[model samples]
Target: MPSEIKLVNVPALGKTAGYSHLAEVRGGRTIYLSGQIAVDAQGQSVGTGDFTAQARQVFENLRLGLESVGLTFNAVVKLTVFLTDMQYLPQFRAVRDEFVNTAQPPASSLVQVAALVRPELLIEVEAIAAAP
Candidate 1:
């Protein structure tokens, strides 16, 4: 982690499962990544009906996005997750933990929606990162 970034788990907010309560970044370049779905470079869907597969592909896309700007998952400070159904929460967490720094995970938000731009898409994830 960069010296300019700080991850905090607010005592008042109680324990967090896999994310921090707050992420503070000072003197760094902030990067905003668009929502990533389970799509490959050729614009083909990677996962059809499998939520876990889709979630993994989404994270992989985010990883590539971060790498494009000379950063890694460690530089990520926040994540916004959207799921077509809340039932996929457990699967999402499992996939997320494989990529993020769980010890000092980034602040995160999860929202359940009725559907995505594509019916086959089960999840979408956007991220914010800070790099010195």
Candidate 2:
């Protein structure tokens, strides 16, 4: 875990469903990753027309992006999630929890969009991470 980046779930904001309310970074290099969709390196969709599977794929994609910079999921401080449907919140959380650290969850935002770059894509996620 990177001490420069800390995640805090303040009480002022109600209970967190699976993310921290705030993530404060002390001093480190920050990386902003472009929104990652549910597509494999081969340019094929991993999970087509499936919210949960696509959500899982998105997290894995994020993980790989961070790993390229020698950072793990804990190094991530914030995540911006875009979903095609808001009703898939429960399913998305379930898959997100599998990749995100519950003890040091990242600050997050979920936005329901009318659609994504592709109709088959149900989820896209962008991440911010810090590395010392």
Lowest summed lDDT window (length 10), candidate 2: 1-10
lDDT of 1 by residue, 12-52 (tens): 88999899999999997999999999999999998899999
In lDDT terms, which candidate is top?
1
lDDT of 2 by residue, 1-132 (tens): 777777888888789888999988888799999999999889799878688888888888898998899988888889999988888889988888898898778899999899899889988999999888
Per-candidate TM-scores read 0.98, 0.94
User: What's model 1's TM-score?
Assistant: 0.98
Off by over 4 Å in 2: none
Best by TM-score: 1
Off by over 4 Å in 1: none
Model 1, C-alpha of 95: deviation from truth (Å): 0.3
